[model samples]
Target chain A: MLRDALLIAGKDLRLELRSRVALNQVLPFALLVLVLFAFALDPDRGLLARATPGLYWVAVLFSALLALQRSLSVESADGNRDALRLSGLDPAGIFLGKVLAVATQLAVLEVLLGVGVAVLYTTRITGWVLLAVTCVVATASIAAAGTLFGVVAAGLRVRETLLPLLLLPVLAPVLIGATRAFEAALAGSPSEGWPWVGLMGVFASLYIVAGVFGFGPLLEES
Target chain B: MTTEAHRQDIDSTGSNGTRVLGIAALIAMAALALFGLVLSPADANQGEVVRILYVHVPSATVAYIGCFLTTIGSAVYLWRRSRWWELVAYASAEIATVFTSIVLVTGMIWGRPTWGVYWVWDARLTSTAMLLLLLLGYLAVRRLPADHEVRTRRAAIVGLLLVPNVIIVRQSVQWWRTLHQKPTLLANGVGAKIEGLMLFSLFVGFIAIGLVFAWLLIHRFRLAWLEDQLDEAGLDVAIAERRAEGAAS
Candidate 1:
């Protein structure tokens, strides 16, 4: 399973490297959200700065939808899904591989968005450790959920319209927890953020286990 | 013969018992409204507006029952692949969404008269809102085109997934709300002192709502079965057309 996971991850990552979809498309979309949020909210009132963590997370959540869709859509074409099924790889491996690959892309998306907020929203990171850890944990949580839900929406004719509706509500806990954690961390009371991090970790692990155990039957459909 | 018997049991039209449940619900609601709205004494705090509690609380409890039923239906459908269980899950989710919406709207109405605001970030209210959204998503997934029984399998998985996720959403929302600078007005609105007719009224509300839920579930299940028949007929037509075209070609 681990070997297959690595192979799948490598293949997806190589696809991203060759195609540059994340760098070319989703990253800029995240930045555009930041820019748009700045326009919608008063930038000088200190409210935007205070709310930067949450707005950033929301942007990341929306962009993650696009990444998750691509994660599955890639396999939908050129007989790739059939090849996957016939390859005799464990479904759990394919599931994890997709999560890992999406997480990697989202990690980059978060960093770029992180820098954009610092510049555009005038947000300062007082507790770097808390912020860093929240980014990692929340990204994984989003990726796990996004990948699981992506498959749920994958084969449907209305997949593009369906994936966000199915996924966004489930990821609310992540958004709430991670946003709260970032708020606490940016407020310099890093202690207050740890519990939210724990919440994110719990959410992430639950979804990882869900994807592993739940993917068996789901994979056959695609 | 047993499979045929089971199929007949499920596929049969609505029964006389459904009428009984419907009548029981109306009677219970009339009793609850009388006692809660007129017979009960005014509260020292919020007065008559507090009577909304009877309907609102029952909406929440029965909604939770709907959630529980859906979770069970989702599990059994997954394990047994029974058409009955899938329909049960689908119907329960729709009923749950309706009751949950009632909880939100009625709570908002109660809030305005009492708290002078129509909304608050109270944990229970917020969580119910999330539950409603999740239920809508489940219903949306169920509406997707039927191919390979895919809708049932996927929706059952989502319904099952929702059970655990709701718990997590509840816990996280509760924790998140605590840090808010503004506290929810009437946070513990319903748990305050109550006795005599008010308490009994709540009981009547429960019976009323539970009966209504049963009535809705039965009719909704029959509707879903009818839908399944339509889908099967539609698929057969498409297949026959394809066969005719292929033969002509």
Candidate 2:
């Protein structure tokens, strides 16, 4: 199962590497959003401190949404989803592969956005280790949930609109916790902020298990 | 009776039953509305805003009923693979969304006058909004494509997964320090701070609104099922026409 999952993950990453659409589309959008935030605030350092966490997550979330929609949508639009299901691979493997790809794409976006925010806003990245840990925890949760929901929503014909609406609501808790944890870590608040990180870990596991269990039947339905 | 024949018989018998229910619900609603609005005395402390409880409590109860029905309907459909349960679940979810919306609005209206604000990030309000969103998501999933077998199956999964949301919504007050008031009547097999005619009026209002919700659910379910049937019929006609054209050629 692990080997099969890696193969599927490799296939997705290779396709993305060939097309370059996910990185090309998502990076520009993330960078533009970051620059827009910078200009909108007009180089205020204090405002940046307050807005940095929110701005960063918003960039990550919207960019992840863009990447996620593109990732699952290709199989759906080309009618290759059925073929994937019949390829003698486990559906859970497909879900795991897609989620890993989403997580990787989001991780790259986060690093870039973090650097942009630190440069443009004159903000310090205190507690680098904690910041990195929080990012991974939050990113894992968001990507897992997003991939799970993206697959579910992709089964429908009107997925482009419905996916975000359905995905956002279910993901609200993760967003709430992740944003808080990220903010706390960046501010160097304290170890007290770890609860929200714990919450993200729980959410990530729940979504991963749900995706593993549900994705097979869901693909058949599609 | 066999499954197909049984379903046909049920479908035929359901309309007359629904009409009788409609009339009965209408009368109950009218009577309760008058009693709760006109006949019930004002509370000594809360004044006219206390009257908002008439609508608010009933709407909350009906929303609960709607959510409960969705849970049951979703489960039955998933277990039995029967379309009837799916129709019922979809119908109940639609009605629940409207009532939950009303509950939020009425609560806000009552809040503005009593709490001196139109909105707060209170636990009750937030959780109720979450419940409303979940319901919308469920309905949207069902609506995006009208495939019964596939749609119903996915909807059932979503519905099952969403059960925890209902619990959280109900417990938001106990779990968090919410600005909104707690349940005034029957939190735990008993009423608090309300009794006599007010309590009776509230109970009657619950029953009346519940009946009205049932009436709406039945009507909406039949309409949705009919729409599916019509779509199927249209497909049949299109297929037959194509076969005829081929044969003529």
- What digit string (tens of lDDT, one per residue) describes model 2 on residues A92-180? 88888888888887888898888888887767777676677778888887888788778767756687887788777666666666666
Off by over 4 Å in 1: B1-12, B181-184, B233-249
Best by DockQ: 1
Q: What is the lDDT of residue B14 in candidate 2?
A: 61
Please tell me what DockQ candidate 1 reaches: 0.65
Candidate 1 CAPRI classification by DockQ: medium
**DockQ for each numbered candidate:** 0.65, 0.38
User: Each model's C-alpha lDDT?
Assistant: 0.86, 0.77
Specify the CAPRI tier of model 2. acceptable
Q: In candidate 2, residue A213 scores what lDDT?
A: 79
